[model samples]
Target: MRECLELAPDAIEVDQASVVQRLGSSRTNCENGLFQESFTAAQGFLAATARPRCVVQTVDLATFAGLYDGEGSNDRDTPLEVILERSEALALFVLTLGQTITDTIRRLFSEHDYLVAALLDGMASLVAESLVESLETRFGRHIAECDGKSTTPAVLAYSPGYCGWHVSGQRALFSVLKPNEIGVSLGAGCMMRPLKSVSGVLVAGEPEIHDFDPGYSCCSGCDTLECRARIARVTGPVCAKREVAWICSDG
Candidate 1:
């Protein structure tokens, strides 16, 4: 049975304003009356500055194994009906999570404290990122294919805030990519259903990527746009990273 990727649990922590007591000084540009306006502006900037994509790879599998003796799933298949069912099921799950998280934000923070709330939510996103590592560790951490078919090697899996990727500018990044496929939808204010979700590409390259290889595969195996595939090789490396972001869908 193939094992599915899972993230580290300790990664699931939030950074509320109190979280900043040590990290740095807090800034509140989002004051009353202006809170909504400030938020809207930030959201707009995030959307515009967000790199259409950061990473250059993607992944798809028919089956995955659980971490524990029995957790998520084991065998895998990609029948058309099964794919649709899985997509809908997972999308619904995302939507349900989005709704629950949105409700929490509304109840927890003041209108002006939205930014702080986003930080805290990003902390929660760390859990999802574990999969990036888990996949890398369990499978082949880097590029394994030699002929032409394999997963991409994630050099950096950056999200908002890490490299200037902020939460506000990502309003429309996650709109309809797969709303029906994964129950992801944008609220009137542009918040994704699962307020804790994020968006960012995984920077990757082939095993031979060294020196200044601009022509190198920046996207690994995300699309047919990367290095050639390995010959007759089926096994591949794992890919994982934290999907944390209070609402980090900038790009």
Candidate 2:
């Protein structure tokens, strides 16, 4: 089944500390006037312009693998590939904080207001991610409910530009997800317009399935090994295991 979720702006809880950290500054160090001003401006922009929307469609492993293989330059052997192989279910999702935020960021940049622009951009990214996290949680709950299982599946999202997935992979993803329904468009190099948008596959299965050593060829060049943190989120007690029988339709 396919689901289109329209999220209220207030539903996205943006962590100010995380936004500050993304800006390469900590909350303690952000007491300076410039940082304070930029952050306040970013909050105002978010409140006034943010509109979060997400679309998700579930697909069987075979179909998901085809999309993965279609991305020509992608590393076939990687943790993401292994995780997908082990997944009981998969869903492709795309989300955006709407075009207004993107336009605001660009306008700020054009006006040489780089500080506020940076802060807003960072907050938008965090907001987009929070939407993804919410979707993951919802999908996990849906899986448990459908299966009448007591244990909720562990869900983790993997994007085209991350791990070993080639950025060009977004082309195949967009072809399926069709994020344009939510005013997001694919541009040159498979980059999504509304620059604050995010697209990826949510993998659901046993928590242990997501645990893997980051020793693949793709790991060498990675500066921020975010996979470790992502994996940690899902590692825990064993749960009932079953292959999801649901097949996602092309929406």
Candidate 3:
């Protein structure tokens, strides 16, 4: 893992729509009132404050098993196990906007500016997601360069605590990759220290899996109200209107 590794990405473009979605607003709703003010402020805060960083380690799937299984499993089937079944190699990464972002959030909360805090939170998440997307882009190009195939490679990224994988298993990720190098640490609760950080594995060349979009903004599989907004935008039917009614009714 140490012999062949890529340092965390430096910086990435912030996706405003995704940030607004994370703030619980749709593309249309993001255009007005507090949502617009918060969105603009969030963009400014990100422009001045966000410090995007990421680290990627390329290893054989077998090495991944040795690291993950050796640490421990959550009783539920580990996603690494599934990836190992199909792939010979995988990319593991830990990414975070520096601690300053979290510090800003704490200060915002102390100042009772909850709206801005929430907006900053969304901005941080979007930056992390963008980092992951950057990794996918680079990995696909790397694979294509090595294989020289006309078709682009397919890669899947999965994180802990989602898709039935237990959050406790995140310890194994920290074990193999030195999150400390990128200014991240693991808490006792299996959470990343910077709070806005994300860690996950990227699996490539698995024939069993069909979809290979390495990023997600909104979907039914997600629990965010933005999923309903996405559905309504595309299909003209509001499947989860009640789910997001509170946002409209909020004081």
Candidate 4:
């Protein structure tokens, strides 16, 4: 599983526009030369320092509840239950951009280069997204082959912190994923280390459940007011500063 889940750093593509928007400006308003320069530097750093890794395993949907160890109630609308209703199996996964990216951001914060650092923070998010995209593609192909289908099946990755699922559900996630196999570990607070890492389940049986189009913004489902995933609406210079602070504050 570990051998098949190693994600090469080059596999993830950093979205400069998304990172720039997170910095509080669009391409037109932001200085062309400065944005390009900073973006180039950040992209280079991400490509060079990011060590993308992942682990994936298939589990029977019937036993999905056992993975939680009787943690949550038998509520029909619970995230796991919702997933099980749509699929016969689940692909539990853990993915990360590795410690190098986190360490680089820490160093940048120490040096007071918050602008570039925050941009890197946003870029790291994209890198993780790209990793998941790649994983989903591969998962779809493999599942199709197993079922003797002409087209790949769909795969949707959902994390504990999103949807109605409380972030504490990560305890259950780690119980099944063993994230450390991919160089990821849960912090004392249940947040994954490396800051940019992500984990969750991928339901594989239904197209409507897992067939999300590429480029569907995760931001649409996220409402965290200060999330780095939130695109800046030209709020103000202070808003951008708050984003930087949020990233540095063990985000």
Candidate 5:
């Protein structure tokens, strides 16, 4: 949505369709019904705002994002193996996310349950934040493609709550990201719904200054091609919307 130069070289590969479908299905058939349509309106929001200032810029954050391991999802005092073995913790982990998202994709289509719809939409906005990171990777790739100079791929996604960043940092991140740059906006309830979802920045350069920790690399490592249209996306191809529009327009 941001009208700058072309994108940079993208790195991470994940099934965007699978993730969205999974999010939608998990929201619908799972314990709670969640509604996720941020991706659908991301472009529309950009179209509405039409300002290039909100687009996010690419930056190397190995130092900023992966600076400390003590701030990870793992407890500082606990060991990795112990944390993995704690079923209670794992259940809470899944359930917390589940509660955060009511029933995904259903309310977006039907709009019958207002409260559930709100919760689902809210969670979708949060998950949609990843799109911002993915775009950053592609933007990085675009920089390389257009510039014709080789560049390193993104090391990892650096969001708040990882390393020493408190989740509260979302405030600053939302503000600094400024959706208008890329055609997105944040809601009064801190929800970047519709299109202005928020994510953090991490550049690829000077590994000596910062590099992702091996222990938590899995979270950032993206070798899998999961997005439905990875190649086109990197080439600045936005995902097709016929099916998503059908879902939204259906009675």
Candidate 6:
């Protein structure tokens, strides 16, 4: 069954430090007057505008493998495929910060309020990520519950348009996940409509499954290489294994 999540704005937790970092400026060096004003305005706008929503549907490994390969153009040998093949469970999900935020961003840009617009744009990206992080944690707990075990599986999300998963792969994914039910639509080039939204599959398995060398052919063109930091969070010595719980609500 597909699960729906309606998250409160405060639950998204967009901290100023993270916003500053997302904006390409560190708090320590961010003393510019305009930057400060924009940052403050972005925070306020996000607080008033963010409407975090998510939909997730879990599928057996075989089903996901078909979806992953259905596109026919994806490089099956990529690190993302390797990690997912090792997963004990998988779920497809779409998360959006709602249309109002994107509309406001367009308005800001039209009015030449570039500074605040950029800051809000970056902050919205962070909030979308934060929503994914929360889902991963909750889904990890749900896995433990379903197995009737005390395991703390590491659940991480991987999307198309990166790591050799062709952007067109979204077609196969959207066919099954049907994000349009929650107002997220795939447009030309497979970009989600809200612009601040994210869609992907969450893989649950031992933390070690996520570890991969960054020397893969796909990694050559990638600039972010964000998987390293995410893997480190799960595999690090201080990584905590919390109990799993169901991610969807009856309400």
Q: Which one is best on TM-score?
A: 6
Supply candidate 2's per-residue lDDT for 249: 27
The global C-alpha lDDT for each of the candidates, from Candidate 1 onward, is: 0.32, 0.82, 0.62, 0.64, 0.34, 0.83
Against the true structure, whose lDDT is highest?
6
Query: 71 in model 6: Cα distance from truth in Å?
Result: 2.2
Name the weakest run of 10 consecutive residues (lDDT summed) in model 6.
241-250
- Candidate 3 lDDT score relative to the true structure: 0.62
Reference-based TM-score, model 6 = 0.92
The segments of candidate 5 whose C-alpha lies over 4 angstroms from its true place after superposition are 1-54, 58-130, 145-152, 162-164, 180-196, 206-251
- Model 5 lDDT tens row, 1-251: 12222121121123335544545555344333222344334323222322112244432333223322323443343222222222111000000112112224354447555434443344345434444444445544555576576853332234444443444545555453443433344456444444323344433322222322234433344354232132233233343211100011111
Backbone clashes in candidate 3 total: 2
For each candidate in turn, the TM-score is 0.33, 0.90, 0.73, 0.77, 0.37, 0.92
- Candidate 1 per-residue lDDT over residues 1-251, each given as its tens digit: 11112222233333334333433444463235554464444333332322211111233222211111122121222121122222211110121223344444454466656664553333334323433333332223334453244654434323322222233323323421334333455555445545544443233334332112223223332354212322111123532233432222322
Ranking by TM-score: 6, 2, 4, 3, 5, 1
Model 4 spans with C-alpha error above 4 angstroms: 1-4, 68-70, 73-76, 210-251
Spell out the clash pairs found in candidate 4: none
* Residue lDDT tens for model 3, 1-251: 33222322233456677776667776886677886787677667766776666677787766666655533544344334544577635788877778888899889889998888888877777667655656655665567777887754555566776644567768877777877876788888788988888887776764344222323322325564332332232234432111100011111
Q: Write the per-residue lDDT of candidate 6 for residues 1-251, one digit (tens) a residue.
A: 57887776665556778777877776876677877888888888888888878889999888888888866888746887788768898999998989999999999999999989988998899878867887788888888998998876989899988788888888999999988777899888889998888988989999999998987778887899898888987999887443222245436
Off by over 4 Å in 3: 1-11, 26-30, 78-80, 206-251
Residue 72 shift from truth in candidate 1, angstroms: 39
Measured with C-alpha atoms, the lDDT of residue 51 in candidate 2 is 83
Off-target runs (Cα >4 Å) in candidate 1 are: 1-97, 110-122, 125-154, 158-179, 187-191, 206-251
Ranking by lDDT: 6, 2, 4, 3, 5, 1
